[model samples]
Every structure is written in structure tokens, then in C-alpha cells.
Target: MALGLKIVLTFCLSFSTLFPKPIVCLDPGHGTKNARHGCVDEAKVVLAVALELKEQLKQNGFEVVLTHNRLGQDLKAKNPDQDNQKRAQIANRAKAFLFLRIHTDSPSGVSAIYYPQTHPNRPLAQESQKAACLIWRQIKTVLPKTLPQGGVLPESRTKIGAQNGDLLVGSKYSRVPVVTIELVPMSKIGRDWIFQKKNQRLLAQKITQGICDYLYSQH
Candidate 1:
């Protein structure tokens, strides 16, 4: 009996070791109250993106979670300056394979943000950089109309960096790989442009495909 119990315990442990959990967290930047480009709100747009990302990731066999739901709560208690502590929590808890914070660019262009390796971030930072590059490349390919600003960058050079905010907040606080993808310029798009429901779905699909490609490449 004792031998059988030992064998059973060992088998369970070995099985767990062989199959590490897969976790992905999504954070939609800003809130519904925050206005973007006078037409659409950051809260609404980002939430849409996050939902789409969750569904797509599910289809690809990932255990996904969202840091912030539609409800409002303090996202930045530990790090008051950056409203991304919620993102950090998700990263810390799940040891997430990827924690993607979705936001929209301003000034009529598209860009992505991640903490550079030269900064406090190191090897984990490199993963984020790679993910950002993959996402940017895929976005550029799918949406030729959107401008390809660049890859993981210092805050100073980025639109988020130029402004006084925590664009790099999640990366700074995150323990696992993290990346922020700026889909498009909400303010730059005119009413005549691609704000239709079909276009939104297309953009979401492109972004989802980009992130999934990055995740698969890692395996």
C-alpha cells in the first residue's frame, strides 16, 4: 500500500512538471470616461479589443484573463503613478505567457510600447521587445494604411513618453513578459474613414493574429 501511494504521488508530480500552465492576461488601457479623438472613447475601443483578444486566445487553447472589466476600481494602488498595477497583479499571479495592454495611439498614427532592455528591465524585457516587433510587423502587413512607428522604445521617444503618464508602467511592474499594442489613432480617423462595424472586426482580427503568431513562435 505504501509503495502504491508513493508511485501515485510521483506520477502526479511528474505530470505537473511536464505540463506547465499557460496563462494570458489582457488589459484595456484607459476607461470609458476618457475621450479619444472627439468621437470614440478609449475605454470602449480598448475593451472591444480586449474581448476580441480573449475569444481568439481561447480558440488557440490558452487560459486567458482580463485584468480590468467594465467596472471601475483602483487599478494603481501600489504604483499610484501607473494605472497598470492591475496588469502587474495578473502577470504576477498567472506567470502569464503574455500580458497585453491594449491602447489607441493619438496624433493620427499607430505605435507599440515596451520597456527597453537598457532600462531596468532585462531578459524579460527582451521577450516583450520581440513580441512588440512581431505585433508591429503583422499590423503593418494587415493594415497598410496605418503607420508603423517602431518597436519597444524609451518613453521619451514615444507618444506616451512625450506625454506625462505611465505608458511604460505595466512593463516596469510586470514580472513576466508584457507588451502594449497601440492599435490606431482614434483622433486621426475621420468620420468618413473606417469606423464601421466591419472595419473594427477586421482590425481586431489582425491584432489577434499578430499576437498569436508571436506566441506560437516562442513555442
Candidate 2:
């Protein structure tokens, strides 16, 4: 290589190493086709929350990537397993530091944090849980008491995951710290509060803070 070319390349490499922005992948789970909570589908609400969270994260000096094509685009899948894997692949290919899957649950559901099951062969399970706990703690401090908190839980603890050795497809395939935060239940109280514009922004701010806490702890 030419001497000047090599020097410029070396400088670029060093600069990137010192100032690389951490990449965060946000997967807004479910959509229009998803189960209807009252008048709105699950996807409609989650899309709103994810979009707000994306803006918040960007403002906090992180590069955020959405698995969907558009702001509220819902990716299609022929099968359930494929749908989950496709979402995880987007994060894996981006090599994101964290994969945050956002969703809302039924009336009885609690706002909870779920981490993947520990796997002897997979190194990230433990780290996933560690990150989850930190995010959970941070969120708890900010989220209002009106929203019920379910605390941190292993993936296996959930019903759907329990059938698969406690591992969700996304959780099993993710190469980075993966956590799911179910924001609210479908009940009247949960809906009225979460759907409010101010609350969505507040939720975004809180989630961003939680992510910030986990990222800082890593260093």
C-alpha cells in the first residue's frame, strides 16, 4: 500500500476505536395482526412506545437500529419460529450491544423484565441476566407505582418459554445481551395511562436511562 494511504487508514481505525458509538437494536414485538386489546391492536401501542424510545436513545448518544423497515413497519413471517429468528438475526447482524424486545401483555400481565435461560454452551446468557437486572432496577426507580412491576425473571419462568426449556426463540438466537420489557397490561387503567403522549415519552426516558445504567456498568 502507498505510505499516505496506509497512514490515513491507520488514523481512521484508531479514531473509530476511540469514539465508536454503541449500537442498540430495538425490536418492537407484535403488530396489527396481533391480538386486539380493546379498540387498538397490540402492535399499534408498541410501535408508539418503540418509536419514542428510539428517539430518546439517539439523543443519549447511542446508535439505535429498528428491526422493522419503517417507523411502525411490522415484518411478516410465514411461521412463528421464522418470525422470531428473523428479528434476532437483525440484531445479531448489527452486532448490537443490547437487543431490547418491546411488547405489551394481557390484562393480568405485569410490567416485567425477562432474560434468557443460562446455557452452558452459550456465553451471553449470564450477561443477559446481569444486564436485565440492572435495567430492571433502573426502570423500577423511574416507573410510577401505578404500573405493576413483576421484577426480573428468567425466560424459562414464562409459560411460552417453559415449553421450550425456558428459552424463547429470540433469546436463544441472540448473540448479545437480550432483554424483553413488557410495558403495560391491557386493562383499562393500563391502557388509559400508557397511551397518553406524555407517558410514552416518560416511558422512553425511563427505558433510556435504564439502558444507560447497564451500559455504564459494563465499563
Candidate 3:
């Protein structure tokens, strides 16, 4: 190699080492069994949003991975236990900077973010809470008029918990910072609005902005 070319390659390698690409793992909640209300399929909608968010993140120079690619597939697991395990494994193996699980709730106009109440990985849980708060604030700012007045919640705040009192399967198993974003209280009117293609795109854009804001703030 020419002397000048070698110097340039060395600098590029050093820069890559100093600032590795950030990998984000996205889990779109539910699958085929999860019922659809009106014209909205919860699984399908979340997956759509996830796909858009993935692209947005990529454009921002972050590496993004989805737990599952399609609507019917459930992370190649036979049961829920295996499903969650597989999801967590994907993030853990990727050494993801963040894990975001997207979900939507019914009876309209509600939105909230959640973090694990307590976990063996306490530091990770704390980080999750911090990210959740940041993302919640951003979402509230963007959808103040449309979503319900909800705040970031810890898993312990709710009575109904996921396996082993974790409140969410992916949250329980994840070793990385993780949060679940639930767009909820979907009243009849809210459902109609959410199913619109334009609205879906807008929602995706807001979420991408929030994630970018959170990541940038950390650095």
C-alpha cells in the first residue's frame, strides 16, 4: 500500500474503534393471535411502525435489528417463554445499545412508557428507566393533544405482571437497557385515527425523533 493510503486507512480504523456503530434492538409486540379491533391489527401496526423506525434509525447512522420481521412470526419460538428468550438473546448477542419494545393498547387516547421495576441487573434497569423517561417526555411533546395524560411507569406499579413478576417478558430477560412504549386507551375515534396511513407515518417519525434525542443526550 502507498504510504499516504496506509495512513488514511489507519486513521479510519482508529476512528471506527473510538466510535463504534450503535445497535438498537426493536421488538414489535404481539403476533397472529393478538386480535385486531375494527380495521386495526395491533401486531401489524406495530410491525409497520418498527419497520419505519428501523429505516429512520439507519438513516441516522445507527444499526437497527428487529426481534421479528413479519406479523405472524413470533421470534421462531413455539411458546411464549421461548419467544421472549429468543428476543432477549438477539439483543444480548448484538450487544445492543438499547432495546425498545413497541406496543399499543385499547379504549383510546392513552400512551405510556414502562421500565422494569427491579431486576438482577439493577444498573441496566436504572438505565432503562432513564431512557423511558426521556422517550416519554419526547412522545408527550409530539402527541400531547392526541394521547392520554400518562407518565412513565415502573413494572412494580401494575398488579398484572408478566412472567416472574417482571411485567414484560422481554424486559425480564434483557441484559441491556430496555423499555416498552405502549400507545393506549384507544377509544373508537382514536382507533380510526391510528389506522390511517398518514398518521402511522407521523407516529413513526415522532418515535424516531425521540430515540435519536435520547441517544444523543446520553453522549
Candidate 4:
């Protein structure tokens, strides 16, 4: 009996060592109360994609959490800024290994990924960029022909004077590596593709694959 128990313990330890679980926090950009643009509801689309991504990540052995689960439910905050801060707080509280914000741009024609360019937390900023690059590579692989001109860009890479000096509110406050993925723009073609249920699922799968790759690389 003692010998059998020792063998069981050894096997369990080996299994854990081979497959470490990491927590991932996914934030779907907007809620119903937030801004809306173009034909499809941006909030709904992102949420749908996030939910799908969550499932895919789980299947890949990641523990996933979402900032918000329902439509029209903004973080319990007074304004958009506060709302974003609360979102970051959720991820920070989770101690997530990675945080991804999913959003879409208007007047669509491009897809982009972004990381904080100016944050007080230097380590977090660097990790965020690394995460962004990994995810961007996956996205580019999946949507080679659709990527925008500049591809993955830092927040500060915008036109000099026009830059938003601070990091995105959620990213600035996050304690974990963070990246925001702006899906193809709302251009006619973008709308046509993104609005399709099948394409959204495919996008989620590709994003999840990239995330899994990044996490595994860290190990």
C-alpha cells in the first residue's frame, strides 16, 4: 500500500509539472451602454468573440476570466474612465498571467494590436509589448491579407501631437501583461467578414492559439 501511494504521488507531480495552468483575463471592449458605430453592435460582437475565446482557452488548459459577462453591464463605475479602471482592477485581482482587450475600429479597413507606450510600471509595459507581439503574429498569420498598413503599433506611435499621452486606462492600471486587439476596421469588407458567426469563431480560435503559444513559450 505504501509503495502504491508513492507511485501515485509521483505521477501526479509529473503531470502537474508537464502542464501548468495559467490564468488569462479577457476584456471585451465595450458594453451596450458604451459607444456604438457602423452596422453591427460593437459591444455584442466583441463579447461574442471573447466568450468564444474563453472557451477555446479553457480547452487549451488555461483558466480564463472575463471582465464582464453580460451585455449592457458596465463595470459599476460613474464614468467611462472609472469603468475602464475597474476592468483593470478585475484583471489585477485575478493575478492573470495575460490580459487581452478586444475591440473594433470604425471606418474599418485595418486590423491592429497595441500595447501601452507610456506607463509608470516599466516591467508591465515591456511584458505588454511582448504579449502584443506574440498575439499580433498569430493574427497576422490568420489574416495576412487583411492587416493594416502599420500592423502592430504602440499607443504612442500615433502622430506626435495627436498621441494620447497616457496608456490606455485599463492597460495603465493592469498588474499583468496586457494587449488590446483591434479587429479589422468597420469598412464594408470588414463589416461583412466580422459580422459572420463563422468568422468570429475562427478569429477566436486563432487568438486563443496565439495566447497558448505565448504562455507555453514563457514556460
Best by lDDT: 2
Q: Which scores greater on TM-score, model 3 or model 4? A: 4
> Which window of ten consecutive residues has the lowest lDDT sum in model 4?
4-13
Task: Mark the regions of model 1 whose C-alpha exceeds 4 Å error after superposition.
Answer: 1-21, 32-40, 71-82, 113-115, 144-154, 159-167, 188-194
Candidate 3: misplaced stretches above 4 Å? 1-18, 32-40, 144-146, 158-163
For model 2, residues 107-156, the per-residue Cα lDDT tens digits are 88788889986644355887788778877775676566777879999888
lDDT of each: 0.61, 0.74, 0.71, 0.74
Reference-based lDDT, residue 166, model 1: 36
| Residue pairs that clash (backbone atoms under 3 angstroms), model 2 | 156-166
Instruction: Put down candidate 4 lDDT per residue, 1-219, tens digits, no spaces.
Output: 245334433443354457666788999887834423323577888888999888877765678889888888746677776787888998999999998999877663468888886777888888888888877776676553654545778876533213446577777678888888888777776767777888898888778766755664565
Model 2 TM-score is 0.83
Give the alpha carbon lDDT tens digit for every residue of 110-168 in model 3: 57888997877888988888888877765676553755756898876543354367556
Residues 1-219, candidate 1: write the lDDT tens digits: 245334433443353356764577887876623222222566676777677767755654567788777845555444443455556777779888788877767646555555435435577767877777766665565443545555555545664445534346556677877777666666455222335555556656565565665655665
State TM-scores per candidate.
Answer: 0.73, 0.83, 0.81, 0.83
Give me candidate 3's TM-score against the actual structure: 0.81
Q: List the residue pairs that clash in candidate 3.
A: 107-185, 107-186, 107-187, 108-185, 108-186, 108-187, 109-148, 109-185, 110-184, 162-167
CA-only RMSD, every prediction: 9.6, 8.6, 7.6, 7.3
Which sections of candidate 2 miss by over 4 Å?
1-17, 32-40, 69-76, 120-122
